[model samples]
Target: MSRFLFISCLCTLLLACQHSPKKNYFYLSPISEKTVTQTSSNVSSQLIGIGPVDIAEYLTSSQIIDNQSDNTLTMSDNAYWAEPLDKSIARVVSLNLTQLNNGRSFVNFPWRSDSKPHYSLRLHVDTLSRTGKNANINATWELIDNDAKKSILRRNFLRSIPAESGAKGLAYAYSQLLAELSKEMDEALNQNP
Candidate 1:
């Protein structure tokens, strides 16, 4: 009886050790209304599309990456993105642009041809990673006039924001970076329009 009981306990322990913990999923959030600066309503009627937002190859994974040093990057095993990072970024940027521009209409990519937007914003993210105590983003963006089929404005942005110690902090920092980028884009549109 004792031998049988010992074997059963060992089996239970082994099974328990094999069970993996639940993964934590996170998503990028939009900027709060309080942080948004009100702009003139003249451009409210313009329909803008945010799309073709590309990210670095390393960021395509669902795993969140943290840069321990200049040379070391750690992909989190237990933390995951709720959706594709590139799509999330495009969605968040669209939302932010709507808030910043007040009555402006913004849509993510994949709109029907009949409802094409007047202007399209294209973004390419070179780097978006948490390094040490900061989250950094480097990107190049262009605004194209769809009617003329020409590029009007192009710019590059690099930003590093202080981040907290965990994945949540890193996500928040990235969100803030996007918000700042939206502001810059809004300014560019106002200048060109």
Candidate 2:
């Protein structure tokens, strides 16, 4: 009878494991596919050094965070970023910025030792809030001239976009927000850089 009970429990556990849903993984993709044509007259492809991006402490995790209520935040263990979230943002932002520039040189931060960037861009993400079907990113970015020690431009950009409802949709919203930021940065670079 003990043997029979053990077999039944083992079968139950195996069946339960088998019936569990598979975990889903997601990644953020660049907004630009291959190349961004130089259509905007002010666009310059000068090498821009972007890096050391700072993310909010709460958002610095693999799990996608969702604010279910004013005091409740939900994190999905099953839905995770394929890579670190901060690194992914850098890649996506680079893709967007490259298109805005007329030059072909865009470099991520911690660049080659000998490389000299035209402008150094830094970003601090204040909030990447996904409250409901809508998502938004509130970030502040600054640009500095490589040759000069003075600050070139600083601004806060906030954009809201539609999110699908899951990880995939959230990624879509983030991509859109990055594209908006790219456009703004392009304008800043063109103004006097």
Candidate 3:
């Protein structure tokens, strides 16, 4: 009967599909490298100060909230194409500071100062989120006068990064962002007396 033949063919097809091995693939595109811009060799030796950044205690476990809603995606899940909110950003900030100071002197936070410094830096990273085609980094940089207990310099730095599709792409974007931040910091410090 045609009905019997049709049922038999369906069962054979189902069995074949069930027996087929499942396949998983990860596609990563080639990431383009960006070059660092060279700045003038002239730099001041004034020892600037800095307080600890108030980043999330468990950055790796943190997530970025959706722009449309309060929904957050864990850094782990986002790691498929990019880095999470972990130590990577912190490390980038540290490197920027070191490079800015020219590696001569950098005082750690929880500072036990014997004397007042020329200027103290306090940073608050309010948001570091990723949108559809861009990553948004918003931060407040404050330069406090140790003796005055008041801010001498304050600026908000916001960077918009083109969305990266892969892990390498994410890294490349962060690197570029860090470089821009460093430039901004340098200019801020230079304007200070």
User: Among these predicted structures, which one has the highest TM-score?
Assistant: 1
Poorest lDDT segment (10 consecutive residues) of candidate 3: 24-33
Native-to-model Cα distance after best TM-score fit, residue 62 in candidate 2, in Å: 0.7
Estimate the TM-score of every prediction.
Answer: 0.88, 0.82, 0.60
lDDT of 3 by residue, 15-48 (tens): 9989886432222221122333334324444555
- Candidate 1, after superposition: displacement of residue 177 in Å? 0.6
Q: Which regions of candidate 2 are displaced past 4 Å?
A: 1-20, 32-37, 40-45
Evaluation by TM-score, superior candidate among 1 and 2: 1
lDDT of 2 by residue, 137-172 (tens): 999999978678667888999888778887788877
Ranking by lDDT: 1, 2, 3
Q: Which candidate is the best by lDDT?
A: 1
2 versus 3: better lDDT goes to: 2
Residue pairs in collision within model 1: none
User: What would the TM-score be for candidate 3 when compared with the true structure?
Assistant: 0.60
User: Better model by lDDT, 1 or 3?
Assistant: 1
Residue pairs with clashing backbones, model 3 = none
